[model samples]
Target: MIFLSMLRLMVHDGFSLTDATPYRHLVSGLQYLSLTCPDISFTVKKLSQFMHSPSKTHCQALKRLLHYLKCTISFGPHLCRHPSHHLYAFFDADWAGDRDDRKSKTGYVVYLGGNLIS
Candidate 1:
Protein backbone atom coordinates (compact mmCIF):
# COMPACT_ATOMS: atom_id res chain seq x y z
CA MET A 1 0.00 0.00 0.00
CA ILE A 2 2.71 2.40 -1.00
CA PHE A 3 0.79 5.38 -2.23
CA LEU A 4 2.60 7.88 -4.38
CA SER A 5 3.47 11.02 -2.45
CA MET A 6 2.09 13.14 -5.27
CA LEU A 7 -1.10 11.16 -5.62
CA ARG A 8 -4.16 13.24 -4.86
CA LEU A 9 -7.64 11.74 -4.71
CA MET A 10 -10.57 14.07 -5.03
CA VAL A 11 -14.30 13.87 -4.43
CA HIS A 12 -14.87 14.18 -8.16
CA ASP A 13 -12.21 12.75 -10.44
CA GLY A 14 -14.48 12.80 -13.51
CA PHE A 15 -15.05 9.08 -13.06
CA SER A 16 -18.34 7.30 -12.58
CA LEU A 17 -19.48 6.72 -9.03
CA THR A 18 -19.88 3.21 -7.71
CA ASP A 19 -22.03 1.54 -5.09
CA ALA A 20 -21.09 2.73 -1.65
CA THR A 21 -22.17 -0.39 0.20
CA PRO A 22 -19.19 -2.58 -0.68
CA TYR A 23 -16.75 0.25 -0.36
CA ARG A 24 -18.07 1.18 3.03
CA HIS A 25 -18.09 -2.42 4.15
CA LEU A 26 -14.51 -3.04 3.10
CA VAL A 27 -13.26 0.25 4.47
CA SER A 28 -14.88 -0.52 7.80
CA GLY A 29 -13.05 -3.82 8.00
CA LEU A 30 -9.83 -2.11 7.06
CA GLN A 31 -10.29 0.25 9.99
CA TYR A 32 -10.04 -2.70 12.34
CA LEU A 33 -7.09 -4.11 10.45
CA SER A 34 -5.30 -0.80 10.80
CA LEU A 35 -5.03 -1.36 14.52
CA THR A 36 -2.42 -4.06 13.95
CA CYS A 37 -1.23 -3.01 10.52
CA PRO A 38 0.12 0.43 11.17
CA ASP A 39 1.61 0.47 7.69
CA ILE A 40 -1.90 0.72 6.28
CA SER A 41 -3.36 3.15 8.81
CA PHE A 42 -2.75 6.17 6.62
CA THR A 43 -4.08 4.46 3.52
CA VAL A 44 -7.17 3.21 5.31
CA LYS A 45 -7.78 6.66 6.72
CA LYS A 46 -7.53 8.17 3.26
CA LEU A 47 -9.88 5.60 1.72
CA SER A 48 -12.35 5.99 4.57
CA GLN A 49 -12.87 9.58 3.51
CA PHE A 50 -14.67 8.49 0.35
CA MET A 51 -16.97 5.87 1.85
CA HIS A 52 -19.89 8.20 1.27
CA SER A 53 -19.37 8.56 -2.49
CA PRO A 54 -16.69 6.28 -3.78
CA SER A 55 -15.88 6.70 -7.46
CA LYS A 56 -14.20 4.24 -9.80
CA THR A 57 -10.75 5.58 -9.00
CA HIS A 58 -11.45 5.37 -5.30
CA CYS A 59 -12.67 1.80 -5.68
CA GLN A 60 -9.55 0.96 -7.61
CA ALA A 61 -7.44 2.31 -4.80
CA LEU A 62 -9.41 0.27 -2.34
CA LYS A 63 -8.90 -2.85 -4.42
CA ARG A 64 -5.20 -2.20 -4.53
CA LEU A 65 -5.20 -1.86 -0.77
CA LEU A 66 -6.97 -5.18 -0.46
CA HIS A 67 -4.39 -6.79 -2.67
CA TYR A 68 -1.65 -5.30 -0.59
CA LEU A 69 -3.22 -6.70 2.53
CA LYS A 70 -3.52 -10.12 0.95
CA CYS A 71 0.12 -10.08 0.00
CA THR A 72 1.19 -8.93 3.46
CA ILE A 73 -1.20 -10.94 5.54
CA SER A 74 1.60 -12.33 7.68
CA PHE A 75 3.05 -8.94 8.47
CA GLY A 76 2.19 -7.19 11.71
CA PRO A 77 3.67 -5.74 14.86
CA HIS A 78 5.36 -8.16 17.21
CA LEU A 79 5.96 -7.45 20.86
CA CYS A 80 9.33 -8.26 22.32
CA ARG A 81 9.65 -10.51 25.33
CA HIS A 82 12.53 -8.49 26.73
CA PRO A 83 11.36 -5.00 26.00
CA SER A 84 13.91 -2.20 26.18
CA HIS A 85 13.33 0.96 28.15
CA HIS A 86 13.97 3.26 25.18
CA LEU A 87 11.11 5.19 23.64
CA TYR A 88 11.08 6.86 20.25
CA ALA A 89 8.60 8.83 18.24
CA PHE A 90 8.51 9.73 14.58
CA PHE A 91 6.12 11.98 12.71
CA ASP A 92 5.54 13.54 9.34
CA ALA A 93 3.14 16.15 8.05
CA ASP A 94 2.09 17.48 4.66
CA TRP A 95 1.11 21.11 4.48
CA ALA A 96 -2.32 21.45 2.86
CA GLY A 97 -1.98 18.02 1.27
CA ASP A 98 -5.66 17.39 0.81
CA ARG A 99 -6.64 18.60 -2.62
CA ASP A 100 -10.34 18.51 -1.86
CA ASP A 101 -10.25 20.43 1.42
CA ARG A 102 -6.75 21.94 1.48
CA LYS A 103 -6.17 20.49 4.94
CA SER A 104 -2.90 19.31 6.37
CA LYS A 105 -2.31 15.60 6.91
CA THR A 106 -0.05 14.48 9.73
CA GLY A 107 0.90 11.06 11.07
CA TYR A 108 3.04 9.75 13.89
CA VAL A 109 4.23 6.47 15.28
CA VAL A 110 5.68 5.70 18.69
CA TYR A 111 8.02 2.83 19.38
CA LEU A 112 9.09 1.31 22.67
CA GLY A 113 12.00 -1.07 22.60
CA GLY A 114 11.88 -1.34 18.82
CA ASN A 115 8.22 -2.34 18.89
CA LEU A 116 5.41 -0.09 17.79
CA ILE A 117 3.25 1.10 20.65
CA SER A 118 1.17 3.79 18.93
Candidate 2:
Protein backbone atom coordinates (compact mmCIF):
# COMPACT_ATOMS: atom_id res chain seq x y z
CA MET A 1 0.00 0.00 0.00
CA ILE A 2 2.66 2.47 1.01
CA PHE A 3 4.85 1.31 -1.88
CA LEU A 4 2.06 1.65 -4.38
CA SER A 5 1.22 5.08 -3.01
CA MET A 6 4.86 6.11 -3.19
CA LEU A 7 5.16 4.85 -6.75
CA ARG A 8 1.94 6.55 -7.69
CA LEU A 9 3.42 9.70 -6.27
CA MET A 10 6.63 9.19 -8.24
CA VAL A 11 4.87 8.46 -11.49
CA HIS A 12 2.36 11.25 -11.05
CA ASP A 13 5.35 13.48 -10.34
CA GLY A 14 7.05 12.23 -13.57
CA PHE A 15 9.21 9.30 -12.40
CA SER A 16 9.12 5.81 -13.96
CA LEU A 17 10.48 2.23 -13.79
CA THR A 18 10.57 1.20 -17.41
CA ASP A 19 14.30 0.96 -18.07
CA ALA A 20 15.54 -1.04 -15.10
CA THR A 21 15.26 -4.60 -16.40
CA PRO A 22 17.86 -4.84 -19.14
CA TYR A 23 20.73 -7.12 -18.09
CA ARG A 24 23.44 -4.50 -18.05
CA HIS A 25 21.18 -1.90 -16.54
CA LEU A 26 20.15 -4.31 -13.77
CA VAL A 27 23.78 -5.20 -13.03
CA SER A 28 24.69 -1.56 -12.80
CA GLY A 29 21.73 -0.84 -10.58
CA LEU A 30 22.67 -3.69 -8.22
CA GLN A 31 26.26 -2.48 -8.09
CA TYR A 32 25.28 1.10 -7.36
CA LEU A 33 22.65 0.02 -4.87
CA SER A 34 25.11 -2.28 -3.14
CA LEU A 35 27.53 0.55 -2.54
CA THR A 36 25.18 3.43 -1.93
CA CYS A 37 22.37 1.49 -0.25
CA PRO A 38 24.11 -1.27 1.67
CA ASP A 39 21.02 -1.63 3.80
CA ILE A 40 19.31 -3.31 0.87
CA SER A 41 22.17 -5.43 -0.47
CA PHE A 42 21.56 -8.56 1.57
CA THR A 43 17.89 -8.46 0.72
CA VAL A 44 18.66 -7.94 -2.95
CA LYS A 45 21.26 -10.70 -3.11
CA LYS A 46 18.95 -13.20 -1.44
CA LEU A 47 16.32 -12.21 -3.95
CA SER A 48 18.74 -12.95 -6.74
CA GLN A 49 19.23 -16.49 -5.40
CA PHE A 50 15.50 -17.18 -5.79
CA MET A 51 15.00 -15.39 -9.08
CA HIS A 52 12.91 -18.39 -10.13
CA SER A 53 10.48 -18.45 -7.16
CA PRO A 54 10.37 -14.92 -5.81
CA SER A 55 8.63 -14.55 -2.41
CA LYS A 56 6.56 -11.78 -0.88
CA THR A 57 9.79 -10.53 0.65
CA HIS A 58 11.23 -10.48 -2.86
CA CYS A 59 8.23 -8.44 -4.01
CA GLN A 60 8.79 -6.05 -1.17
CA ALA A 61 12.46 -5.86 -2.11
CA LEU A 62 11.41 -5.06 -5.66
CA LYS A 63 8.95 -2.39 -4.49
CA ARG A 64 11.82 -0.87 -2.57
CA LEU A 65 13.71 -1.36 -5.84
CA LEU A 66 11.91 1.67 -7.24
CA HIS A 67 14.19 4.00 -5.33
CA TYR A 68 17.11 2.90 -7.47
CA LEU A 69 14.97 2.92 -10.57
CA LYS A 70 13.69 6.39 -9.71
CA CYS A 71 17.25 7.55 -9.34
CA THR A 72 18.49 5.91 -12.57
CA ILE A 73 15.46 6.02 -14.82
CA SER A 74 17.59 7.44 -17.58
CA PHE A 75 19.83 4.36 -17.97
CA GLY A 76 19.55 1.60 -20.61
CA PRO A 77 21.46 -0.36 -23.17
CA HIS A 78 23.04 1.24 -26.25
CA LEU A 79 23.63 -1.17 -29.12
CA CYS A 80 24.81 -0.52 -32.64
CA ARG A 81 22.20 -1.66 -35.11
CA HIS A 82 24.78 -2.39 -37.77
CA PRO A 83 27.17 -4.61 -35.87
CA SER A 84 28.68 -7.73 -37.45
CA HIS A 85 26.46 -10.80 -37.62
CA HIS A 86 29.14 -13.43 -37.23
CA LEU A 87 28.31 -15.33 -34.07
CA TYR A 88 30.93 -16.02 -31.45
CA ALA A 89 30.93 -17.56 -28.00
CA PHE A 90 33.29 -18.40 -25.16
CA PHE A 91 32.93 -21.04 -22.46
CA ASP A 92 34.58 -21.36 -19.08
CA ALA A 93 34.57 -23.84 -16.22
CA ASP A 94 36.44 -24.58 -13.06
CA TRP A 95 36.20 -28.32 -12.48
CA ALA A 96 34.98 -29.21 -9.00
CA GLY A 97 34.87 -25.53 -8.25
CA ASP A 98 32.52 -25.83 -5.31
CA ARG A 99 34.61 -26.78 -2.35
CA ASP A 100 31.63 -28.00 -0.37
CA ASP A 101 30.01 -30.17 -3.04
CA ARG A 102 32.88 -30.70 -5.49
CA LYS A 103 30.66 -29.40 -8.25
CA SER A 104 31.91 -27.66 -11.37
CA LYS A 105 31.14 -24.13 -12.49
CA THR A 106 30.18 -24.24 -16.15
CA GLY A 107 29.10 -21.34 -18.30
CA TYR A 108 28.27 -20.79 -21.96
CA VAL A 109 26.35 -18.37 -24.13
CA VAL A 110 24.91 -18.78 -27.60
CA TYR A 111 24.30 -15.78 -29.84
CA LEU A 112 21.95 -16.86 -32.58
CA GLY A 113 19.86 -13.75 -33.23
CA GLY A 114 22.02 -10.95 -31.88
CA ASN A 115 21.06 -11.99 -28.39
CA LEU A 116 22.48 -14.37 -25.82
CA ILE A 117 19.94 -17.18 -25.78
CA SER A 118 21.64 -19.51 -23.31
Which candidate achieves the best lDDT against the true structure? 1
Q: Look at candidate 2 and give me any clashing residue pairs.
A: none
Return the TM-score for each candidate structure: 0.62, 0.37
**Across residues 1-118, which tens digit of lDDT does each residue of candidate 1 receive?**
2776316988885576645788888899999988877788888898888777888888888888888889988776678765577889999999999999999989999988778888
- Model 2 earns a TM-score of 0.37
- Given candidate 1, what's the lDDT at residue 10? 83
lDDT of 2 by residue, 1-118 (tens): 2233222221122223343344334544676676655545654564455344434444445656766557766654334554657676879999998999999999887664465534
Model 1 clashing residue pairs (backbone) = none
Identify the leading candidate in terms of TM-score.
1
lDDT of every model, 2 decimals: 0.82, 0.53
List where candidate 1 sits over 4 angstroms from the true fold. Answer: 5-7, 77-118
